[model samples]
Target: MDEESRNGGPDSRQFDVSGAKINILSDEYDPTVSLISSNEKWVEDDEVPRKEVGTSSFWQATSNTVALLLGTGMLALPYAVMLGGWSSLALLAFFAIMFCYTGCLLGSCMKENPLLTTYQEIAGSALGLRGRILFTIFFYVEVLANRVGFLISVGDNLARIFPGVESHIPAWIHLSPSMTLASLAMLLISPTALIRDLSNIAYLSFGGIVTSLVVVGAVAWTGTTVVGFNQPIPFANFGKWRFILGLYSYCYAGHPVVPNIHSSMREPSKFPVMLMLSFTIATTTYAGIGLMGASMFGKETLSQITLNIPRDLMAATIVLWTTVLTPLTKFPLAVAPIATELESFLPFDSHSTAHYVFGNIIRLGILGLILAVTITFPYFGSTLNFIGSSITIITCIILPCVFDLVLHWRTIPKLQLMVDIVFLTAATCFAIVGTFSSGGV
Candidate 1:
């Protein structure tokens, strides 16, 4: 049930700020909230109807956040650790702390401007329409590319399950790995993609987290028992250190979804605790997987840790297929924001049949586009690198720090402002070097 329905009318408010209540009858309502003028500013926006009503809890939010951060990104960590050597482990820990800082900035921004639920909204509020446009362009590029990468993974693993299953067909079939896998991805992800209410799919997100844990456990077991240890790489490879920063940045790529998860929680203030819990679990999993995979396989670690598993082992197949399933579950939630942002621009009645019809149309259209990209260029690692270097940096480190500085420029202490400036400078340099290195230029 929606907040309005539960509260008996649009006039009812979930949070009381300044003893004022704003009524938001529907999703189409404008989000204009009155702000408190005091030092500790607060937003009282009623139009941004409570997401998930009473169903969303702290643990659910944490699990979903884990599900988002723990997918495909972790798969590449073993390779990232290999690239940067053992020092990459230290870098991962340091970045995890930095990530938590930026995440809190995002949360604080959302609290100050409660009307802002989406990144585009936050960008527009801070930097105007052009900023919104800039953020939107970058967001869609990153999201679509990430989804395409997921589809490619699905296709590749499905092909692996039935090796030579394609060759049994006649000559005219002409099914390459990309083609076969792309078709399979569409078939697998379409049902989840059609889900409009993200709260309903929370279980799927929970399952994804569990699946990732299983995969991690399986990889750790295989890395310890089955895989033979080889001479380890150096502590840090200065030559390719840029690539490690980008890949590790990708491994912590959950900042973009902070607002969405924050908005869904029963109490937004608890978001920081949730973020801390989720990131702790995520970093532990990442360090263990990366260190174990790199230590066992050494220089021969594949880009995906699962690939290092001996194929004949049942654990290998399970991890491969779980890798496929986790992404399929995550693809929908990742793309929902893009669809929601697009829908706000079109002329469709929220209560009419056209809105329902058109919403699915947009969702399916996105799936179709991802499928086409997977078929056209099924390369996954390069795509991952590009996303890590480009949008991931923007959403994770750069934008949040910039936004916080702009939002609290005068209110925050000079020391805090200087710290943000330092963060922005360091992250920007990291992004630039990572981008160039990832492109092999």
Candidate 2:
């Protein structure tokens, strides 16, 4: 490859499958980099000028990372355990550790080239323009699918909270109560998508973390007092192992945003520490809720633990409301990176009045697209299963390892290279089997 192609310079712009020009190095226009070279060499840890890099504190970044990981998928861990039996918790822990390691690999890639601010840039830097485009497509689909699952969760929980809501909908509308509620939620969250800064949403992300803990606590309280955890959970059930793997994979669907969170940190070198802390917290929460809910309602646990809680109990009310609130806070964080990338394609200066005018239009268009998909295929469990099996596995488990191996091939130890190859092979197999299994769901 030529020097420009090797470095993924701006002149390397190419057309995607959809016939749209995608500039993989579009960050060149970012004001933050006006004084810095895009091709600068990796700096030493102590050599990085932390005061010039970012604005977010360590805890704020931690909160954002936690919120991103512990989304609608966490609520389904109990159902995953039910499907795969008691042995599945082991798979969950294994995935948590492997994904955390891969996440740190991504942080290392960013550290290798501090100018790479997005996941696509990392891909382009390592594997060239095609890799960048492919990763972009996979990452965007995962985010959109997660948003769809969020709407589906909101619809299901809202319908459960008001059992008579379907009957109240007009016959002419031909919409189910869950669909109506999801539509309303789409409208409610549309405004937040317009926010340009991640720092502004930190508190909202923290709210998501708080609400997740409340839901977990409520599930525990209900399981102990109301449901009586005396049910028999099977030791192993390999019949649905494919679907179970997908569910576990979906729980770690936070890798795409890791780059964004890393970029937002004031001390980006500590990103590995942030990843370890966030994954530890998320894994612990998933395990606690999964064990408790599955034991209490083994073979009968709903896709969302909140769905299994007794409707008449106070714990159920708290769990239901908190579940509803969790997605609202997270919707913006999930879509912001996608929005920024889409806006970069506009034919105007990044700070021009024309860009501002058309940017809000683009954001609204994204919301409209998400709303349409959510309404058409509103099956919560099946939608999540398909996405987790197919897209989530690729983005969260497979690609990070591939990118890291490509970027650090020569310098990485022989054993570490073997480990990345093993992970890549296993994740690919699981993704294929799980996709085929969950595709029929």
Candidate 3:
């Protein structure tokens, strides 16, 4: 498809492509009506005078990317190693490298079409409306799943920090300690989700990075000085390879938000560098904590490494608190794109009073749904595994390569084409195996 066809027609008004408004027509026409009516038209006109709304600097973008990649999933890496064996570290490394490459592929896809501001838009541009819908379902579900996982993690770590808190609950309240803590966390996080600009939350993202480092340091200290790494780590265990692959896939589940981060960058061209730095830092942290926690606890490791830390130790308290903080900072970032997309479907202009009120309502509604899910099926590891296997593989690995190939098939080099096909096939296989394994099918 040509640029006009891919983006929509020349006169259509698109939504959420950019924050700034472009008033091509005079004061006679109602932009809101046109926006609501032609929201499906995704094209940007070259002739229209438009302004870019991106304001994030290189470091801020890098920080957001890092925070997005290294979420509650990091806590599960050691447990993942426990399942797949020590040799699974190689699989972790492979995913880290491949996801970084695929993330760059997303950037490339965005570069080819500047109007493509969301992951769904990238799919829509490549494979049309059906592709966009397919990706939208997977991407939104993945974001919601991540939010649920975050609340579950917050609850898990908080219970670790304050043991026996569950006993204090009144008989009438009918809530577990983890559920209560997660409810409180949801209340605190709901406000941040209302912020429209990614740049505004960059500091929170930086805070997440700091808290992650502290968690990693705490794990290292516990392993080296407290627990001692004497447990034997096997070379390989093919039995749980499916689940292991899903866990590794979960670590790099940041691609859905990549376009938003790229669009928010002051220097979008440096996105590849941002991806490199973000992935490098995240991979190192994952590897360090996974190796240390697995070698220290082995078969005894809990789903969350924070849970494995000795509760009696002061360091465990500090680490648990930091782990609690990590997800609070990340929940907003993960849900931002979903909120933006939901807001677009509303019958109002972007950033208007109606939009603001309804946008907050949408975000709060999303949090409510997440809270309900967290309270109901509070299985952290299973939730992450299902999300990674069933949805994340499609969003992070398969779709980027598919979009790249579809958009640049004729011009793409033969070598790159072959590589994309290989990635597509492998990711498909991994998704099938991991999904069935998670479902016990």
Q: Candidate 2 has which clashing residue pairs, if any?
A: none
Please list the Cα RMSD from the true structure of every candidate, rounded to 1 decimal place: 7.3, 6.7, 7.4
How many residue pairs clash per model? 1, 0, 2
For model 1, the superposed segments whose C-alpha errors exceed 4 Å read: 1-64, 111-121, 169-175, 187-202, 228-231, 260-274, 332-364
Clashes of 1: 1
User: Model 1's lDDT to the true fold?
Assistant: 0.69
Selected candidate, larger lDDT, 1 vs 3: 3
Model 1, range 1-441, lDDT digits (tens) per residue?
Answer: 254533434232111111111121221211121111111112235754333322357887777677667767787888888888877688788778778889888888878766676555677778887877776577667768777777777777777776776767567855685467668668776877777555455445445566778778888778667775554867888677776677778777756456656666776789899999988999999988888888888888777777777889989888888887767776776666566656555597766788878888887888888878777766666567767877788888899898888889889888878878888888898888877777541
- Which tens-of-lDDT digit does each residue in 1-441 have in candidate 2? 234543445344321111111234443212121111122222346755221366667887787677767767888888887788888788888888888888888888878776676677788888888988898788678768877888889989988898988877888997789899888878888898787664465445445556778888888888777888887888878787877777888888867557767776777888889889998999889988888889999888888889999899988888887888767776766566566677778899988999998988887888888889989988777788889889988887788898888888889989889989888888899888887887544
Model 3 residue 360 CA deviation (Å) reads 6.7
Residue 135, model 1: Cα distance from true site in angstroms: 3.3
At residue 189, candidate 2 shows an lDDT of 84
Which segments of candidate 2 are over 4 A away from where they belong? 1-64, 114-118, 188-202, 260-274, 332-362
Q: In model 1, which residue pairs have backbone atoms overlapping below 3 Å?
A: 155-181
The ten-residue window of minimal lDDT in model 1 covers 13-22
Tell me the whole-model lDDT of each prediction, alpha carbons only. Answer: 0.69, 0.75, 0.75
